[model samples]
Target: MIVLAILTGVLTGILSGLLGIGGGAIFVVAAVFFLGVPQHAAQAAAIAAMIPTAIVGVVKHHRNRLIDYRYLPYLAAGIILGGMVGAYVANITADIVLRRLFSAFFALMSIQMFWSSFRQGRKAPAKQQDHDKH
Candidate 1:
């Protein structure tokens, strides 16, 4: 159990750093599926896990000049407000319903990512040709 927990945390950190993602989905999936955690509990754990990881990731991103400071205020405000509201709503929602909703969200997001990748791949050759001409 401890080994699995450590492995999950390590994997989450890797994904977060490599992809600039929050890694909430990774935590939630690992906690619920492998650790036998309840959906609501897993979600709460994932939210908690975000704090340290987000702080570290942000520092690295800032160092790499990947962040646009101009939009920071608005983004921070929205995240804080939305997170509070989301937490409140999530607390009132049933576990099964939340699980189903999370599953559907991931499914839709995965499909969108795949479609975007395909479109980008198709455009790459044209972009390369244009670049070569210049």
Candidate 2:
């Protein structure tokens, strides 16, 4: 059990680095699927796990000139309010329903990512034409 948890964390870290996306979803999925944690608890755990991972991600990306912090205030404000409401709703929702909803959301995201990968892969390189040819 401990090994599985560590393995999930390592993989989530690698994925977060490669994709530049937060690791919360992966953590939540691993908690629910592998660790047998309830949906609400898994979500709360994911939020807890986000702190260190987020700090590391932000620092690394900022060092590489990738971060634009101007939007942080607005985004953070919305997330804070939304998260409170989300948590309240999740707490009142049944575990089975929450599990189903999580599964459906994950599946949809996976399908969208798979389709987007293929679409992006098939794009031809833009050809540079000689503008001086008159």
Candidate 3:
């Protein structure tokens, strides 16, 4: 169990570095499958773990000029509104239904991200045209 946790953490750290994302998904899976944690508790633990990881990541990205802090207000507004609605719905929903819904939501988002990245990879950036304005 301890070895599994250590291996999971190592894999998650590598994935997080490669993808530029927090290891929330990996943490959730590990907690539920390996640690025998409840789904909701796993989700909460995953989120809590993300706090410090995200802070350090943000610092690194900011140093690299990868962060556009100007858009934070928009991001925060959406997050706050969506979080409230999600929490309310989750509290009122049945466990099985919530689980299915969350699974579907994650699947859809993963597909979208995959497709966007694939398309971006196939496209070439616009080149300067000779007919364009000087």
Candidate 4:
């Protein structure tokens, strides 16, 4: 179990770094599907596990001058308030409903990503063609 936990953490960290995504996507899915953890518990654990990764990411981005610190307070304020509200809502919601909602969210995101990727692919060829003409 410990080994599995470590492996999951490593994978989650790698995915987070490579994808610029919060670790929740990998962590929650792994915990729920692979580890047989309950959905709500998995989500809570994912949230907890994300803290260190998020801090490290922020530090690295800050060091690279990629972060705009001026907006942090505003972003933090919204995250804090939104998190509180989301937690409250999750707690009150049924497990099945929460699961379905999560699935829907991911599905929508996947569609958007596919659309964006295809759009970029289409533009790339056009840009290359124009460059060749020049």
Q: Judged by lDDT, which candidate is best? A: 1
For candidate 1, lDDT tens digit of each residue in 19-60?
A: 866688898999999999999999999999878877886899
Better of 1 and 4 by TM-score: 4
The residue pairs found clashing in candidate 1 are none
Better of 1 and 2 by lDDT: 1
Residue range with the least summed lDDT across 10 consecutive positions in model 2:
125-134
Q: Candidates sorted by TM-score, descending order?
A: 4, 1, 2, 3
Model 3, residue 128: distance off in Å is 16
Task: Summarize candidate 4's per-residue lDDT along 2-121 as a digit string, tens digits.
Answer: 889889889988887899787898888888788888889988998887688778877988899999889999999999999999999998988888888988999999999989988886
By summed lDDT, the worst window of 10 consecutive residues in model 1 runs over 120-129
For candidate 3, give the lDDT: 0.77
TM-score computed on alpha carbons, candidate 4: 0.88
Task: Identify the superior model by lDDT, candidate 1 or candidate 4.
Answer: 1
Candidate 3: give its CA RMSD in angstroms: 5.7
What value does the lDDT take at residue 35 in candidate 3? 83
Residue pairs in candidate 2 whose N, alpha carbon or C atoms collide under 3 angstroms: none
The TM-scores of all predictions, comma-separated, are 0.87, 0.81, 0.70, 0.88
Q: Residue 81 error for model 2, in Å?
A: 1.4
* Each model's lDDT: 0.90, 0.84, 0.77, 0.87
Distance (Å) between predicted and true CA of 93, model 2? Answer: 1.0
Kindly report which residue stretches of model 3 are placed more than 4 angstroms away from their true locations once superposed.
110-134
